[model samples]
Target: MAGLYVYSVLVVLLLTCGAVMATKENDQIIKENNCETKMGLPCFLEAFTSIFETGSISNKCYVELVVLGKVCRSALVKRTLENPLFKDLRPATIIAKSIQTWNNCLALIDSPSPSA
Candidate 1:
């Protein structure tokens, strides 16, 4: 029950942080800039940390999202979006999934121990 509470709080915190990683418009920007990437857990975590620790999205990251299409692309997403049937919704879905994946990765990253 404690773990579940923590998880729920984490999600709520994430949602309340004004995370700009939402919306179909962002998806379109990501697609237009061709900044999509196939990043592993570590890479995604690092990138997210840089943003979250600063309490906002950095200009470089924002520009990448808006002008360069630098989104967290996955092999699975690539394969699925390749199907023409889902074209209209593909970009937004991939972006949303990538954000979800990154959040999960962030949760698993150990916080620095005070003893250290």
Candidate 2:
């Protein structure tokens, strides 16, 4: 019984440490990419929900997301997937969708505007 308790505590400690390390890494990525400042709160939430849930991103938010850049976008998705709340989600499916979203946004940004 005591051994089981110790094992449980160790497991908790390990999980906490891993989460902290991941958060720090995420912070560094965010800072380097200027993610927080580049994407406003509303747009960030829109992009996040669009990725993790069945939702669509608005063109305005898409612009913000594309400007936020692929590195920041990928890192944010990876960080969210690591959260316990997303444990049931299939990482590969979500990751594929993320890439698709990025590609779509990039295409929109790259396309020439209609001649006025």
Candidate 3:
């Protein structure tokens, strides 16, 4: 019974150590990703407000917003996937679609206007 208790305690200690190491690695990744620099909340809010005020923004404006939104979303999705906190969440497909949509919007934005 003493031997079994020792084994169990050792197992628990190992698991705790592993968890701590994983958390440290995740923190390093988060720091490297520079979440704040990549997605400034104030900038996003300002852009959103501008879009809302426009009532009916042009395609170019919409495309620009979409590009920024997609970049931000993709970064967050990637960070979440990397972080242990959200490790249980399945791999994301939405980020890929967001990138595709942003690309398509950019193409449209680049194309000449019918009158031009």
Candidate 4:
């Protein structure tokens, strides 16, 4: 019984440590890359919704997201998935959505605009 209890405690501690390290890494990436300033709060929320839920992002917001870059976008999504509020969400599905959204925005930005 004591061994089982110790084992459970160790598991919890390892999980907690892993979460903290992931959070710290995400924060470091956000700070070092000036991710927050890259996109407005409204656009950030739009992008989040677009990736995590069945919401659409505006063209303006798409531009903002594209400018935010893959590293910042990926880290933000990973960090959000770590939140307790998002505990029920599947990380793999959400991550795939994030990548799709980023790719779409990148394509939109990279392609030449149609002539007037």
Candidate 5:
């Protein structure tokens, strides 16, 4: 009966571990999907770490904006707005632009716009 008891414990532990892993995966998927839906881009830091880390298109664009002192957050917001895929994003274009201006101003106190 000792063998049976050990086997039962092993089975229970395995099942518990499996359940935990499944839950973690589900949570990650939900987070990634939420980020994608809101941003109109893949979940770079979450679902597509390799792409982001390796400087894929979106990642490269983000880095460029940051380096240019262009307010990365506004650039991301503009990207989401300009893309037809994220048409359902909230606050309207006017509000989005206002927010972008605020973000840019908050970050870029020196020159505002180099190209302007």
Candidate 6:
């Protein structure tokens, strides 16, 4: 439906904004705050890695991500859910969209090759 398209576009914009504004300083802040006190860095990375690998979140991973959202305030999980476009969607649905967006975004990155 037309509503779905608009909603997807909004998700794309929000994800793009989050990715664009990210910098080394922001990464350090996120690590210092969320990784240590709120959530583990490996947990965060694994959630993302699983999303891309599975094309859908596992039940355990979903629970972990929800808990991460609850305990951490500075990360995308909170803001992504708060966006007007996501207000009507279920938490799982929002996460699915975000994961899909993340997969797309990561595809845009050019990985560095090992030096010979």
TM-score of each candidate structure, all chains considered together: 0.26, 0.75, 0.39, 0.88, 0.30, 0.31
lDDT of 5 by residue, 8-97 (tens): 999999998976675555456545444333433443342122221232234343443334333333334444344456466553653545
For model 6, the stretches where C-alpha displacement exceeds 4 angstroms are 1-21, 36-46, 49-54, 70-96, 99-116
- Whole-model lDDT for model 6 versus the true structure? 0.54
What C-alpha lDDT values do all the predictions have?
Answer: 0.47, 0.88, 0.55, 0.93, 0.45, 0.54
Model 5 misplacement above 4 A = 35-116
* Candidate 4: pairs in clash: none
Would you list the clashing residue pairs of candidate 5? none
lDDT of 3 by residue, 53-102 (tens): 22333465555455555535455445455566656645545345445545
lDDT of 6 by residue, 1-116 (tens): 99999999999999988755653444555566564445456555666455323454444445455555432433555444545665675767556756564544344333454699
Candidate 5 TM-score to native = 0.30
Report model 6's TM-score to 2 decimal places: 0.31
Best by lDDT: 4
Give the least accurate 10-residue stretch of model 2, judged by summed lDDT. Answer: 47-56
Say which candidate scores most in TM-score. 4
**Model 4 Cα lDDT, one tens digit per residue, 1-116:** 99999999999999999999999999899999998899999999999889999898898999999889899998899889989999999999999999999888988888999999
Of 3 and 6, the candidate ranking higher by TM-score: 3
RMSD of each: 17.1, 3.5, 7.9, 1.5, 14.8, 15.7
1 versus 6: better TM-score goes to: 6
Q: Higher TM-score: candidate 2 or 6?
A: 2
Ranking by TM-score: 4, 2, 3, 6, 5, 1
